[model samples]
Target: MFALLPLRRLLICCLSLLALAGCDRPSAIALDQQVYIWQRQWRAAHAQALVASHADFSTLRVLVAQAHPNEGWIQARIDNDLLRQDGRPLIAVIRLDGQLPRLDSSAIDQHIQTTVRNWQASGLNLRGVEIDHDCANNRLSAYAQLLHTVRAELPAGLTLSITALPAWLSSKALPTVLQEVDSSVLQVHAVSRPEAGLFDAQLALRWANAYGAVSSKPFHLALPAYGVALTENGDVESEAPLPQGGSRRELHAKPEDVAKLLRDMQAAPVPHLTGLIWFRLPLAGDRRAWPLVTLQAVLHQQPLRSNLQVTVQQQGELFELRLVNSGNLSAALPTLIRNDAAHCESGDGVQGYRLQRAANTLEFVRQSPGQLAAGQSRALGWLRCSQLDHGGFRVSP
Candidate 1:
């Protein structure tokens, strides 16, 4: 018995090393482009930059939504193919309805099988499939069974993955649920009540570390890459102005917020960490979101840049001061713009702009520090005078 001790120790050591390798932190992350509305292009150049910044692959969201509780699934079509066929593998993301019934799993599975097969036939190379379901914690068993059904029908050699919730990790059924899928994505960013903010960096770190300690399955961390404009009436809009939604209170994670998340992950990486996937890819119209450079910087663990360019432009009847961020991160503006012979007034529906009178100069002050995101430009306010390049009317440094 004593002679077998060394051999047993060696076996244990080998198993430990294999486990460590499986849990190694991500070297390459992925990007998810959820195409819900019509877009003119895919921004292939930006995607190429993402790949150059250690992005592994792109997952295009092909929504499999249900019109009614009992009705069949309706597959949303991809509009403008922004990504070029550059031989990089793409994953087809199938998102089901949050309130979808467990009884409909059979039909959903069949639809998924047909949908994936059709995607394969479209001449686009596919790397795998990801099913996004926001099922309740108690229903994990049913979800697990559904996953098994879907896996059995998937084409051989194709990978299968799922988007998992933080709450699911603590449930007793998570282990068995994990066994059904090849990989899982832990989503850390989500919409919360307006008062609670959009994301919590500390909470995300704790959850990521906890998952690493429990599960041995390879998983990706999903972070938010998009922003939403939430209004007083609780209406949400993305990128563009919402005419019917009234004034918007922007809810988004700044570049520094995302940077902190990345740093926290590196400090305490999950054991089974495969990679990361941004919640949704940014397009040109997504003015409230982070730019490609910012995303690249976060992935590479580089410091964010601050480049704010100020300019004045005249409209039909009004002259406005425009502030643009040209760097990789957002910045709080210089509070005051002082000029001796000019009167500045906040534009209609604009908050945070006020004017103060000094002995000889008028100080146009931004009462609240508003964040201006990189690559996004906004009109600060209008000047009562139409003269351009007024010497005394310069912004405070």
Candidate 2:
């Protein structure tokens, strides 16, 4: 008994160290980054945008079909040539109307099959299909059946995924629904009503952990990279011009908030959390989406900053004032701009700024709130001053 005491103590110590090692083990899953190109129409700019963003995103999830409330089914006109040239792994997404009375499983399956065949015929590197449906919790079981049937209909090489909602976390059928699909994407952004705003980082983190607990298979979190304008009549406009009628409120997800969330998630990763999928890739002229540089910086865990400068160009007596954002982050337009110029003949502001000229100072007052995307320039106004000091311009936020 005396000889066994030291051995037992050594055994206990080894067990304690093993338990600590188990507790400190890193997650086995590596995060795969992806982006969604949700544009309905593909243009030259879209092609260029895809080329620019091809390296950052591992997979491209393109919108293939959308079910409208009254227009029935609308198919997206994808740029096959561009997609083939890019040669990235593709996952076609089909959005279903949540308010639909019933599911047309057969028709949907046929559509999915036809789409896959056509894309493959076009030489696209198609790898999978993702169904984006935000149905009620009670309907999850039915949704699961639909997914199961769809999975059976897809080709052997193709995988199946679904866009999940946080609301379904409470449902007992969530596990069953998750089991039907090969993987899932938990959309935490814009899941609430319009009044609730676009994104809540804390709430999103909580939802993600909860979803990780429920989903057995690997899953991704769909985060926002764009803003939406909500109209007084309850109309939401994303990547489109708001109709000229009622008042509108713009809701945007701050980059800093999202970066903080990403850091926290990296520090303590949720279970089975595979990666993040940014919603809607940013195009050159996309006013609502974050600039590509800003998005890239956030994804790469770089610092975020915006350097706004007022530059004046002179062609003889005519001077053009412009606002230039040279930093990696988008910046809010300055509320005021003052320039010291004497003998100003005439000056007028353009693009929502009003010019006020005093004895020796030119003041440009902001008429509305706006954002200046990174690496972009906007013409504030032009000035015609005989003795203008271009170096004496000041910008006030």
Q: Report the C-alpha displacement of residue 324, candidate 2, in angstroms.
A: 1.1
Query: How do the residues 1-397 of candidate 2 rate in per-residue lDDT, one tens digit apiece?
Result: 3555587889999999999999998654457899999988888888888888988999999999988678889999888999899999999999998988888999899889999999999999999999999889999999999998999989999999999999999999999999999999999999999889899999999999999988889999999988899888889988978656878898898888889889889888888998999987999788889989989988888999999898989998899999999998988999999987566888899999999977778899999998898889999999998888777878899
| lDDT winner | 2
lDDT score for residue 296 of model 2: 91
TM-score of model 1 relative to the true fold?
0.72
* Residue 230 in model 2: lDDT: 87
Clashing pairs for predicted structure model 2, backbone only: none
Tell how far residue 130 is off in model 1, in angstroms.
1.0
Q: Which stretches of candidate 1 lie over 4 Å from their true place?
A: 1-72, 79-86, 191-195, 233-236, 239-248, 311-322, 338-371, 379-394
88-128: candidate 1 lDDT, tens digit per residue: 45666676657765546677777777767776776666667
In model 2, which regions exceed 4 Å deviation? Answer: 1-30, 242-244, 342-346, 357-360, 386-389
**Maximum-TM-score candidate:** 2
Positional deviation of residue 160's Cα in model 2 after best superposition, in angstroms = 0.4
TM-score for predicted model 2 compared with the true structure: 0.89
